[model samples]
Target: MSHDALFQLGMDLEAHPAPRAERAAGPRSTTQTEDTIVAPVPARDADDRLDHFIEKQGIRCAGAHLIIDLYEAERLDDLPYIEETLKTCVEEAGATLLHIHLHPFEPTGVSGVAVLAESHISVHTWPEAGYAAFDVFMCGDAKPEKCVDVLERAFRPSRTAVSELLRGREVA
Candidate 1:
């Protein structure tokens, strides 16, 4: 569930989820003095914060996003197996999982997402083609690279293709 949804249900997940903050169009705080107005300064410090962006390879970014493609994969239509794999990925990546939601398409195929405190892991599968696509994105100290190995073991993909992108790469 989303942060607001969690609150509505009387559960507080976190003080501020970084993923939503980066993309939210919410109310802004401003201070008006006798002559001019002072714009709000965002909270960027890491004090008392559990998850935040980090510097990787001399480039500062919010997180790493990995595009993993599995070919000749097995059990692309099994929802339970897929869910377990996602959970395992989250655990292996050292990311905190918040919620999991999956959908099974008609005929054959399963798509799912595992929401994490660091970020998220999503999957799209094609059983007929023996293929699956997975996206593992996380920030802070979480290691998204670990998911590739876990996925290979779970799906038993004969061949895999992987690509990486640094999310929220700020301009210098």
Candidate 2:
């Protein structure tokens, strides 16, 4: 699929929202800047927010999705080391982990997920190529960006790249 199919979500960037929620008092008013629109939601009781969507960069959405790549990396095929590194990433990201499951592939590659309360961190490795790809998606207060640093440090990659997507951005 093309970049537009992946990120744009059929939203016309220049269009303004037509309907408004019950307005907020004080400084919690809505505003628009550039391509993003910011709107304040009415306060809800703590028990009502079970899914943990968050407000980021003025847009309310599900979470941050980080696409991470590691090149010229080390320890790509080590199962135990991969598990440890993922645990470290979850800790460093401040995400609550529920479980970790990893599988080692033929000849020597690894794939796994660190399931978290907010979301998950998944990895797929190509040991022969000294490359690894990771996806870290989490909601709430979990610092998904921190995982990029942890992965780089743990793998000692000569080259690293990351991209972020605001998941559920169309929910407005």
Query: How many residue pairs clash in all the candidates, one count each?
Result: 0, 0
Residues 56-135, candidate 1: write the lDDT tens digits: 88889888999999999999999989988888898899888777777788999997778777888999999999999999
Winning candidate number (TM-score): 1
In model 1, the clashing pairs are none
> Worst lDDT window (10 residues) for model 2?
22-31
Q: Write one digit per residue (lDDT tens) for candidate 2, span 58-86.
A: 99999999999999999999988988898
Q: After superposing candidate 2 on the true structure, give the runs of residues whose Cα lies further than 4 Å from its correct spot.
A: 1-51
Whole-model Cα lDDT per candidate?
0.81, 0.79
Residue 159, candidate 1: alpha-carbon lDDT: 100
